[model samples]
Target: MSLKITFSLTASLAVLLSCAAKKNQQAEADCPPKPCTMEFRTVGVVFTDSKGDTLQVKDFSVTLKATGKKLPSGAEQSTDAANPFYMIASDGDKSALSVEGDTVVVSGTHPSSGQVKKTDFVISGGRCECHINKVSGPEKIVF
Candidate 1:
């Protein structure tokens, strides 16, 4: 009788320990102890015509390449076609751009544009310094 009780107790203890170990292992796998940090920046230029006339771009797009990642966005502006200059602005820490008066400024760090890393977070601005000319018709201008 003593031998049977001892064996049963040992077996029960082993089963309980195995279950506890499994639960702990599953919890560890479910939650990662360390999180990754990602950062980026956006850089580009604006285009204008020769007669100081701002060209109206129907659909403007920008692409940033880094870490095999591509980020794209569009711009909106007045449809007068005479003063049809559009400005792009960043929305959050992820990245964005905006227009201030005659200058177009880009904010945030793009992975491919400059020497930025995931560890170092930064925000910057660049001007699309272009000479303007008379707007005659529809055209594509790059800054």
Candidate 2:
């Protein structure tokens, strides 16, 4: 290509990349300071036995990533890692949430399934997290 044509193409490419980078940075800017930490109580879990009976336990803990999100009201919310499907609430409950460890433990009620206790609580999948806004996954239920 001619020198002038080559220069024009290079400049155009640079601008396109810059624009794309800016857009990406803007999207991530909603995150609270890097490595932001928060705690959430009330994470739901399911432990079942072979007899179709849920395992009764005093506490349950699991690790998960938490990220920050921008609410429609211009507010900020914490989500599980890079996915917004799992939200971390501010209201501190019995649920023990650890950002550093990326783990959470929920306790209080004895383990029981909807069919076993006539309640609508069951964890069919191995493990999953769901947002409290009612964005529950087909494999998991986030109460």
Candidate 3:
């Protein structure tokens, strides 16, 4: 009887340990790693209706903003005074930009934009969204 009881207790202990380990693994899987930072830049060009063909206007401008803390020290930031566009570089993963038809849908990382990660950005004559990946660099906008 004692032998049987010991065996049963051992089996129960083993099952409990296995369940605990599984739960821990599940928790770990549910928690994802944090993201790094990157940088980006933007330039905007305007298209004007000159006679019949569309020409790029050199006097139009737009502004871009990010809902976060200021960029890191020594990080170069620039904007073209001739168009409506901007660039950002954060120590995070790939950022996103959304464009729908002739309008800019949205722009930013996942938590900020609340959009998909790898959606194709649409660019039109009116407005557009632009986001860069992990690197802070220059992006030219052609209207």
State each candidate's clash count. 20, 2, 19
The runs of at least 3 residues in candidate 3 whose Cα sits more than 4 Å from the true structure, single-residue gaps closed, are 33-143
In model 2, what are the clashing residue pairs, if there are any? 65-81, 66-81
Per-residue alpha-carbon lDDT of candidate 3 for residues 26-136, written as tens digits (9 for 90 to 100):
754644454533434332222323243333233222212332323222122235444323322221211222222212222222222233221122232111222332212
Worst-scoring 10-residue span by lDDT in model 1? 129-138
Task: Write candidate 2's Cα lDDT for 1-143 as tens digits.
Answer: 69999999999999999999998578656645544235332333343345544344322222222332221121122233233222222223112222222222222223444332111221111111211221222223233
**TM-scores of the models, in the order given:** 0.28, 0.25, 0.23
Q: What global local distance difference test value does model 1 have?
A: 0.37
Query: Mind giving the per-residue lDDT tens digits that candidate 1 earns over 12-43?
Result: 99999999999857755654354433433222
Q: For candidate 3, give the lDDT.
A: 0.33
Give the root-mean-square deviation of each candidate in angstroms. 20.2, 15.0, 18.8
Best by TM-score: 1
After superposition, the stretches of candidate 1 with alpha carbons farther than 4 Å from their true spots are 1-46, 67-73, 93-143
* Whole-model lDDT per candidate: 0.37, 0.33, 0.33
